[model samples]
Target: MATIAFASSSSGLLFNKSKETSPRNGASLFHYNGLKPVEAKQFEAKGFISTSVRCKTVKAAVSAPKRETDPKKRVVITGMGLVSVFGSDIDTFYDKLLDGVSGITPIDRFDASEYSVRFAGQIRDFSSTGYIDGKNDRRLDDCWRYCLVAGKRALDDASLTKPVLDTMDKTRVGVLVGSGMGGITAFSSGVEALVQKGYKKITPFFIPYSITNMGSALLAIDTGLMGPNYSISTACATANYCFFSAANHIRRGDADIMVAGGTEAAVTPTGVGGFIACRALSQRNTDPQKASRPWDKNRDGFVIGEGAGVLVMECLEHALKRGANIIAEYLGGAVTCDAHHMTDPRADGLGVSSCISKSLEDAGVSPEEVNYINAHATSTLAGDLAEVNAIKKVFKDTSEIKMNGTKSMTGHGLGAAGGLEAIATIKAINTGWLHPTLNQNDLEGDVTIDTVPNVKKRHQVNVAISNSFGFGGHNSVVVFAPYNL
Candidate 1:
């Protein structure tokens, strides 16, 4: 019988054929190459009295996995831009959320006194003076204006100037900004014009501005990016889907940088009436400020919000080569569909739970490692509880994890919700403070997890997940972590 000498090190296991054997303490010594002794009975049957082999010490060389000179290509966020009701600046948006300020107010764009739901998280004092020409701005929808501003602001935040962009390969950049209800205002107006006067009354810019892909198209044109450009309209999950798709684009080497996020300007009269007709909006007309109360016992429904959120995502190697500021690393993300209801969450929460589990797996993280969750709780009765139940299924003890609902402050941005909430999640990682889920005075009975209710909590977040579920049973989750480098 031949004996095989084995040794182990940080590199890997090494094996050699030798009559003399020497084994270090705690090292597995085997009689044959590529064979491991499984049980004590097997060892005794082989007449081996000791677990350690007796042989002369020999330095056996074996090939080991090569370490990467630069870390494997990863997608990192270099800049974040958002146009919330609070403001467009990222600091201002997070400051208001940390301060527990409610952006919800009575819809002043039009007379909403007759409507059951009279308020929303409406953007006020928004101006696209420098970003778009006055005539073009007037012709375009607010969704287009918001997308342009936010996308450009993100590029600015990333320190990407016209000269800098020109120096790089223009074909390696792309835009994926999306909107749930693109140009609702323009579409509504065009329909009204056709009904009231004639076909000639319809503006020529109507089709260009009303389509969902126009935001990304205009962004690409403005930036001279000839790479991949498109829009994903997955209801409230639009932003997360865009993020996931954009990350995959970078990973697959299709683009080195991607301007990805979501935009929405559905606060028109038609938009308000549409949500009201579906009864998906809160009817708490008396207290508009407290209308969005996620995880609260008296919650009614989500408050419609209008804005855009955009992020500059680049391959880590590309960002480092350009000396760009790395905000955070996009660990991973996943999307799934319930295939159950068009407007309601699945009663069993299988879709959401599966989506979350798959996202963690995609991020290469364990459930216990996740400490924070930017919940998709939209203040609705079924939606909030359904998400909670789904989370409970993923995590065993919820005490270690602190979750909050940003919708309490920004209302539901619909397609833009995921992008804004993802910014909040990354801000929490950078700031070590988790914002509160406001108006959570009375907690739901089944929800045992800490909602971080009504006040900011200081805690170090190592790993966080942002959840966004949309109408049509679309479920999306994105995991983010602080960049070590």
Candidate 2:
């Protein structure tokens, strides 16, 4: 049933009209009215407006949330692919995360002794030997290389090989991979050539390879997917935005399948130097592994990471017809802008809180249903607390909701962060084990909620929300749950 909601200033309340439902524990899940204007004033001192609904009780049993019955509108993740610091395989990457193995290491690709930050979660010895042709493999930027390999790997995971793909309708498939710093290496090299040598020294492939949409375009061209193809460049939130948009395309009947996610290879000299100039990188060169401590009071800044994560998203009917293995279901997602700062998050965190609320409403789930959160905790002082504060506004009792930070082990992957984290969320659903947020010594006072610190915990996640907030106050949240037949 379609949900309908109404709000009036005179009434000072918003109420939802939907079917009443009960959880596995036989406790009634009430659709409470939205927060009143008086409740909104709670955030006045923090510099933004916010509203929230109160939950009645906390349930312990894990049960799947309401899913769309219509096959065409229902979106499922058939495959997940990633080129992480650990490796290119999904199981290996997730296993490392669950084991609390830190991937951050000293910058060895270039001379970085003079820089403030000398370490990152850089992918060492990445190769596209079998994926791309010899000539194009060497010529393409790492950003392009990462996405191409990840996207193709995702198709393989979906069981859509060359012979299988040939039988499917090519026009009904699409690609929507994104990158925040698109072709930074190529752009930097082209400019260096123009400055040091001359205009004649510039490479002819500079413009074509340096644009943001080239990754998506090339993936489509290589796979022969002729439907909706484009890229979103919303910094850290790029992957979730792509997933959200790609799922909607399937829901709207524009496409039957999509290769969607984000990629970023910004571990180059220019990328590291730019973050250093902005003072956004941690200089804990002595302890690079423990540098990305999200809720730790000793954290100075975020550790840079680079890689790609892609997912093969398909409609339910399409998957059933082909006898595909479904990984998880894409419930709903929402994006919002803080409209407050370029690099800094809003002190009040109303933007993020609102985005989470909207995502839950769209998913036809309540705050009580979400027992896990893959938070966008980047180990920065203000960012970690701001995200936690925002989360408190939506979830008053986090005692039931366990939140963790993926950046603690992998560092911040910028555009690729959301895609990597989403894979972690789905893994948690399938494995019933939540990875620990490492290096939680001297925890922040305001962060009282359980972060599952230092060790993995066995917990059945009913509904999980993965958040990715970026520069320019772009906030995004995507909901995921186990796929049940």
Candidate 3:
């Protein structure tokens, strides 16, 4: 019942003014602690009004209708969490985004003299120790930490604590989260301790804590989820793949509860130097804050970023039976390969278009119904143009689609890109606002649709998609629809 402030948008809900927020207005329907029901309704005939000791107020009702096809297993988002330079919630993040405030700064995670681009959009104030219990922190890596905090926050937000699978039937519960580059930081540190110091100094838990899949595995361990555990690697599309696979799992009824999302912590010398070697990073070192200017005329390349995004996906009957909050619906997803190049997309965007078409089919929605699109506009010349062309192909009529990218604000998060963008899409649905492409000074190349630029625009978004195409010709698209039932 503590006083808290919250702002809602089609994009997402944000509690920016305060870090720890009171339960939202609608949580009262479930655990408001403000009301109690009487077993006997016969007294109602005597005009005796039922008393509710709880003071919580009902602000609004959430109505998500179940699908007639299969009622028990509709995919619904119960909770979401985000960690970026933009702030935890979507609005705080979008505010920093619209102002063109880049989180990129001088490399502070580690020394980077040899790396051409040392600056990155790193979460300087973040600490994994806080995400994990202090006692268990030593056994976890940066990747696991990011996922842990975000995942914990999501479960809490959903009003569902980590399940005690041992005490309950957990075969229906699962977890899946990916990292574009996981444990690279831990790997770098372990090698230093092993070679420079001594093999004895190396921790015994190096490998499990450092692998990409351990983040999700640790989530399962911490929360006691025993359904499924897996990690996916797709360079930058890692999170999208996680979301895609999670949606499919729900569709197949493989799991009723799937903790899904992605985390990335690859801003070390290995992460920065390797990308620089590929000539894929921006070199606006003089102006680090403005370096990540996506869809801009002067865009050099992408700015490295590190963070995580997490979402709690549950089947409709499960959420309804527990009276959990429903944030959004995961329509479905699609994945494809370019088969053209390892690090470059096809010039004509043939593969990208196919990915979009496939995702639309998976979601059972048409391109015409898609109102907003979170593009993989990393500010690169070929990548930007190619994706736009692909959008044109799949959308058929680009004039109606509202498109933009969050990278201009948070920088390219490599593997975390898809996960963070998915959070952005959910925020858009919550707030009904779409961010303008910051630093896009000019409408260059071929932009057919309405690319919101310079300022944030508010509009209704019933169905939206987020695109993440990573290196090795990996392309992923996820579609989310506002729950109608």
Candidate 4:
């Protein structure tokens, strides 16, 4: 009744080595059946110890196949919401993008005239009338306010009212709203209070509102969702990462519905000064509207923006059961790291290319199937062309894929960029139109892809991918397709 087992020693396999070896070098091990040293050798010589166990284990470990899941449990976007510079309305946001309107304007919230970069895609006169209460609104950061507004709106868009949500299991709903720099204004103000007045001057709500996870926590509290609630921060790639992670939660049956996206409010003095120090802002002070020119030769740097974008995602089965308004299908997505540079992308474009390939593989789509790409070109000289190189590597012909830089008009929303661009991608698929990349008069290099420059174009989009990369070498790509029964 001895057990047969396999043990490893410092020298080699237990059966192959001498049993009398010192403990430092190796130890005499027994099989699961407690075979003696003599019996183990007899079994080993008969190929029981080698081919029957060791070789098979090594082979399985080296060449295991990836498990494929049923595509029927796929996730789909039931609704989309955003608090962009354009407005809280999704139609208004998409319409403004179609007209090639630049949201970049002078930073008038505070005196930024002396700063090198003074313009941003700032949202003015934002009101959370019905979304949040007045007392909490005044106490919370703009980041928290945006999340509360957008998350509730997204649920509304999905037709998931309070009554309907109460009928369903609250534990099956989750929230995963992320941010790159959470509550910058609150953090800066807290620090100033600690320096000038005292720690006592700081508000008690500072810690609760300043953390990155507060956005998701607030959304969950407001909606009473008791499921998985968390935040992901990967700089600019935050939104796409959230979408990818949230979709998997649904696919894995952990949750039936997920409110996922990214929010940011980094338009304060410290936010601008930090980017200015890194020389990552455009100094086109004369014309703030044209400051964010993505592929143009005169492009300097990205114009920082602030906003939140949220998507109400549910499994196809769950959506159909709930009779949700289906918008688009979340085919698949992938995330990768460059591991090359801290602030800049890898010059070789390997990270981006691999990400795109893996995304397509996950979506079970081909390169030719993707007719459009919402490019992550943030108007930077190096980043703009580097993404194009990676796209070219993925789609060799380039003629079939019409890529556009939405950041040209929206500027760089940082953590919320992917969420906003994801909405743009889904909108483009729903409506048969593609927005232009503003201010592309003089192309930067041998750029052959038609950027849909200067004006919107009417095109039928079948499958599309939205690309978003971050400062810390994080690259993410999400694939979307028209939802069809």
Instruction: State in Å the error of residue 423, model 3.
Output: 1.0
> Please, what are the lDDT tens digits per residue for candidate 2 over residues 99-122?
999999999989999887899999
TM-score of each: 0.85, 0.87, 0.82, 0.85
User: Between the candidate structures 2 and 3, which one is better when assessed by lDDT?
Assistant: 2
- CA-lDDT, candidates in order: 0.80, 0.82, 0.71, 0.80
- lDDT tens digits, residues 416-481, model 1? 888889999999989989999999889999889889989999878867899988866788999998
Candidate 3's residue-wise lDDT over 1-485, tens digit each?
Answer: 01111111100111222224234453321111111111211101122222322212111213222223465657889888777766566467766765656677888777776666778888867655445788787656667777888887777778876453344567787889999778887787788899998989887777777788888888888887888789998877888888888877877888888888888877777778776644567777777877766556676677888788888898888888788889888887889887855553454556677788788767766555677899888866456766766777665545557889888778877777787888889878877778777776776666767778868887678688999887677888999877877
lDDT of 3 at 71: 50
- The model with the greatest lDDT is 2
Best by TM-score: 2
The segments of candidate 3 whose C-alpha lies over 4 angstroms from its true place after superposition are 1-68, 89-91, 98-100, 127-130, 162-168, 197-201
Worst 10 residues of 1 by lDDT: 5-14
TM-score, model 4 to reference: 0.85
How far does residue 388 in candidate 1 sit from its true spot (Å)? 0.5
Q: Quote the positional error of residue 360 for candidate 4 in Å.
A: 0.5
Candidate 2 error regions (>4 Å): 1-67
Query: Cα lDDT of model 3 overall?
Result: 0.71
Clashing pairs in 1: 20-55, 21-54, 21-55, 22-55
